[model samples]
Target chain A: MNGFKIIVLAKQVPDTRNVGKDAMKEDGTVNRAALPAIFNPEDLNALEQALRIKEAHPGSTLTILTMGPGRAADIIREALFRGADDGFLLTDRAFAGSDTLATSYALAKAIEKIGRPDLIVCGRQAIDGDTAQVGPQVAEKLGFPQITYAEEVNIEGDVVRVKRRLERGIEIVKASLPLLITVNGSAPECRPRNARMVMRYKKATTLTERQSANEDYLRMYTSHPYLNIEEIGFKDLDANIDDCGLAGSPTKVKKIENVVFQAKESMVMPATDHHLDALMKELIINHTLG
Target chain B: MNNIFVYCEVEGGVIADVSLELCTKGRKLADQLHCQLEAVVIGANLSGVEKQLYPYGVDVVNIADDPRLEPYTTLPHTSVMIQLIREEQPQIALMGATTIGRDLGPRVSSALHSGLTADCTSLEIGDHEDKKNEKVYKDLLYQIRPAFGGNIIATIVNPDCRPQMATVREGVMKKEILSKHYVGTVKNLEVSRYVNDSDFVVSVIERHMEKSKVNLKGSSIVITGGYGVGSREGFDQLFELASVIGAEVGASRAAVDAGFADHDRQIGQTGVTVRPKLYIAFGVSGQVQHVAGMQESSMIISVNNDPKAPINAIADYVIQGDVNDVVPKMIKYYKKNTK
Candidate 1:
């Protein structure tokens, strides 16, 4: 039972749950190729809870990391076609427009240059910044200990247990290891893609995607360096080009509006359910949940 | 020396209605920053929530309590909110985007380097700019929200942080309560040496409560669903029409990622924004992250067999139909018109 070095953190957003009419662009921005980036559905439910705590410990080791741009190495080769043994992209141009405190300070300095690990798991928000606030600001910038919406994590020996998902119910905590979790889209639904690990890590890539492939996919990712999915920019960590991204973000967006509430006159019913249960007891006896 | 704190959130001994709607929106940002609105209250027998947080216009209430600050453990509520924002330097703090303020507002805004703003639906005090020295920062807090998916309304502003934090969302603002008692002063925050006992490394091992406090974020009636309520026994007949109409079911992050409900019964821009008074969207085909979390529900009623469902133009009652044959005929016509 040895195995507990996970990492997860994935992102590559867009696919704003499929919005259209070219999902906004008259000055507000996000027309990110009319949506379709994927792999941020609660970071694939936090990479299936770090592949179920690396299949209940046993030489454990999941990985992933991401940051975005450099086409977020397509969510680090979709977390190595769902099993992840390697992944890290962090991308560059000084982390571009960060926010979420410079994306948790370039992911807590790329999890301290991808070193500290005993679990990190992510995804409590990132449907293009719904702001669950970067895994509790990357567990308060790596001083660790974060459990968040989690939904079943287990481990039990050096502590972990989790189960979170709360908005009024369900909670169970434990925490201890080099912790940090987030998960929840009601966690547990990330398993497909092991057609033999997709014909063995379907060309892993990300050396800027093997320098734009071709030439027999650059001699099979330079003779399979675990098919090379590692692209660390911001000078490979220790980052601090002003704390890494929109000059180390501190919130800021002043005005945007575009809201559309409107509907003040709506009385169209008739599919009958006794007039929708008598207008739900006449709006709960007129306290009008407003 | 301006103020306005409000992290109240007591939970089941009373206090969280989004911390009395962020103290009635921190008593109008503490009467537009003339100062004094406080309210802290960490846990452990959060003693008489200062008379239920002084008619919600507080004026100062603090109260850390103890027994290891009962229940909420985020290293003792982020070291008692980073030592109450560094010994009350609060210019504006606020929380209640629940789940213990999204896990204690970004660890007390990253241990007070400050700048939070998550889920906020509006806060305002105004004056922002400093987009790299375009300088402005006058009485800031703006914070606003709903971006890109609820399609715009951004606002945000931390203009060089200093407790100008935020969180909001829980029926976005308005829980009013100042009919009297703004005569504050309650204090009591010792917090045993800023927490120890290995910061109570996560404790509460069982609190299954979903038993009739039936609050889907203060539900007055909410039947949510979507992904065409197509399975998981169509959300157990939309929770048998939310228990024959006492109501509260909510979902849609495509029926909670197609497992058909339970990311704490999700309900929108990353779940839970509800304003229910009667929301009822079955087979819910309304997205704008589930209609920006129940578009201030005061009567929505959708149903959806897709008559071009965009929650039928902000539904006030648009039943086109088929939530597994209209939610068992609206739960057999509400148990035969309620006895």
Candidate 2:
């Protein structure tokens, strides 16, 4: 496992779980501007898992990769600030509206371009969409075995052991090597940004960020005396243009809507002996208890 | 319009209960659209599965039994599903939102380049007939799920995609009983192009379980305290009340963040959604996210020091007093009632 290269799939998502009146658009799509763009919580958990592996194997290096509109570079910089060895932002106008399938295609291409990796770690699902398809789908596209809902990981000799979270309980599973692990929030919390790493890469930027942040922050990002930003763009990585974005994506959003639950409540009885008996009888009548 | 595909999941050669439940759900959904319900099972010794579909009202059962289907590898499972959907061209696909179903549904949907709705609370079909006399029975699937912290419902439709997919949460719907008089045709499809070792870059060695003592999902009653409950010691008292009531203990997200409870026991959009019959919320503010999960409970009683606490608005009964004071009295009342 020496010199192992780990690639993490990170995303920039609106803080949907904690949104205000300004957080949504008229169409129900998140207003990314009003809501603070935070690193996807699950992706942070994935980064934590990757960092754990790096800690166990000193020679291992972790790189963060993201494909989104250019503003997504903030997620990459956040990752680098947390001790990732490198960051790659796969940005272009073409990648817009890429669903999980198309997103996985572009990411798999990026992973291939980054060279073969020992492992790929991603959050089980992004909070905004909550589809949870991308991680397993990416592993599928990459032709690697994947462990979903990974709560724990242990490596001994050549064998990599993990605890896969099931609905009932956790299942301790082992995948030999070069596998993908999609972590849940239950995975160990990520370590805080290392001051040394923050001092080293806080100013790192993508070419788009450097060119676009055209604001005062852009100057601060580029000229930060203690940091380094190696700008990598679409051309630095080998990818087919058609396969990288919306054109390569076969699935299109027919519609999106806000989901609400209108629930009606009625009571049976409390869990007293008589009420418990009545509840059991009701369940039996409905053929649910027996 | 054609076949309705059902992913019949199996473990150790035995079909899972949820797959059978989906078959029952699919049978009705397909019937409404005037199509045949086709069950797609991938594994060996599927002979019993086909015979068992009759009671569930399945019209046809498709089996792709092979050695590679063993051990539940995502590669082989999704490949088999993709192959079946491409060939059969199901108008709609359904899978249980179990851990396996949640993992597999999206993979197959993505591979087929179709839309998938996850954790659906309800599903129905609506008609969209043209005004002209030439009317075709087109499939209109409406997938309803909770969103906006469960305060709102989102209905997702894939008007253009074939075999529209939805994964349903567990135990939300009832599975129809097998009718004694029903029978269906079961055909075994040959799979020479099954997934092999070469197709897999990594292989699963073994699966272990995590270490958590409480499972809030299965609890009948949850005694959840909130910020008004004060310190962790107050939470401990709530846990004691929970033990006396034979209920699981839960907390609003605030309590969990305050280090009063474990993450699994936290209820809301970011935590588990529960439908317990009796929900006792002590000192909770009833934020939208907190209410989103438990608003559907059979009974809700809120004990808040603040009468104006948001939780009291939706509660069935609001007990306005300090939770530290009121909870003990409620416990005493419950004990007296039980005795």
Residue A2 in model 2: lDDT: 68
Per-residue lDDT of candidate 1, residues B159-277 (tens digit): 77688888877766778878765567798877886676777777778777565344687667888887877778878878876876677887887767667765667777556778766
What is model 1's DockQ versus the real complex? 0.23
The sequence of per-residue lDDT tens digits that candidate 2 reaches over residues B195-284 is 655544345555544545776767878879876677889988898877766788888877776677776677775566788877889888
Note the DockQ of each predicted structure.
0.23, 0.26
Off by over 4 Å in 1: A1-38, A41-75, A79-86, A89-110, A114-131, A139-201, A205-290, B1-20, B24-37, B40-54, B57-94, B98-104, B107-168, B172-178, B186-282, B285-339
lDDT of 2 at B86: 83
Worst 10 residues of 2 chain B by lDDT: B128-137
Best by TM-score: 2
**lDDT tens digits, residue span A1-290, model 1:** 48789898878877766676567778655677778888888788889888878887878988888887887787777778878889888888888877887878888898899898977988888776777888888887888888888878888788778878676578787767888888877778788777877688887777665666678888776677897877778887887688667667777677776555565556766666667677655554565522
